[model samples]
Target: MQMSQIVTNFFDACVFFPRIIFFSGLLSLSGCSNAVEFVQIFTGNNGPTGPNLYHFENKEQLDLSWVKSAMSRSDYEKVLSRIDFKRQVLIAVSVGERDSVSENVQISRISLVPVADDTIVDVSVRVGMVSKECEKNLTSYVFVLGTFEKPKKTLSYGGFDMDNFNAGCIAELSGQPNGP
Candidate 1:
């Protein structure tokens, strides 16, 4: 092939490859944009002892509620003060009781998807595995989120990990020859 033809082909190849890569990158980022951003107000294993999801719209609601029963009054007030109830809300996820204190809960991702006239808040959580038997303990996590509006309008869920933990753990234990 001629040198001119070869140079032309090389330039065209460079331009074509970058466009393809740029477009694909944009496509991938578009999918990730639905993940809602949240500021973690507090997260600890000492939350409510049972699986619970709390969504509070204002400080008055939180102040009058028992959701912070597991937390100190001062600490609860501190968390409440950080929130501007008019602009943000609080979401707490309690993983309930686990077999060991070593076990932990992680709020991996929070996403919002529009459905009909409302939105669905999907929370992705993961908990550490307890390899051995231990005293039952409370495991929980909390986050402060700022949505377009209060989260009362959104349908929320504990996501897959909270829903499937028991079944998955049982399957794993039963499948082993000698499980913990």
Candidate 2:
């Protein structure tokens, strides 16, 4: 090949190589922002029947009302009041229904799972009812408090016979704690 032609080809190759690499790198990074993990929760009758995902940047703002109603008034106040929202808390709400008419009930449970960056929690709830020819429905809700730019939401639903009422829900959260 002529000298001028060879020189032109070398410069063109160098320019095109970097562009290819740069575009590929950009494409890979685009997928990272939308990635998230989820946790699962199960319940018996009277489980959470509405929104299951609650997101909060500060732990102090955590709300346990939905779960507190399931227990006695005194017990509810005691258990909920002791919770330190300053620390990370995974809140799950479940409801159980009986064949006979009654008010909705809420059940609450806590775990000592460590909260880490990009952490997703899986909570399971089991609700029970009493009746010989009974039909029960259970629902569950999960709230994750963290310091993310925006909150995240996820949900699942299922039902079983009153003989062994079973239902469930799931949710996820991302980021770190901002402060109290």
For each candidate in turn, the TM-score is 0.54, 0.31
- Candidate 2 Cα misplacement greater than 4 A, ranges: 1-48, 51-60, 63-76, 88-90, 96-117, 133-180
Best by lDDT: 1
Report the error of model 1 at residue 82, Å.
2.4
Model 1 residue 109 CA deviation (Å) reads 0.8
User: What CA root-mean-square deviation does each model show from the true structure?
Assistant: 13.0, 17.6
Q: Which ten residues in a row have the lowest lDDT in candidate 2?
A: 171-180
State the C-alpha lDDT per candidate.
Answer: 0.48, 0.30
Q: Which ten residues in a row have the lowest lDDT in candidate 1?
A: 171-180
Q: How good is model 2 by TM-score?
A: 0.31
TM-score for candidate 1, residues paired by index = 0.54
Stretches of candidate 1 exceeding 4 Å from the true structure:
1-33, 129-160, 163-180
Per-residue accuracy of model 1 over 1-180 as CA lDDT, tens digit each: 999999887654432211111231242121211455676665544544455556677777766655556466787777767778787766666655544333334567666544333444556665555444432433333222222345545553323235323322221110101100
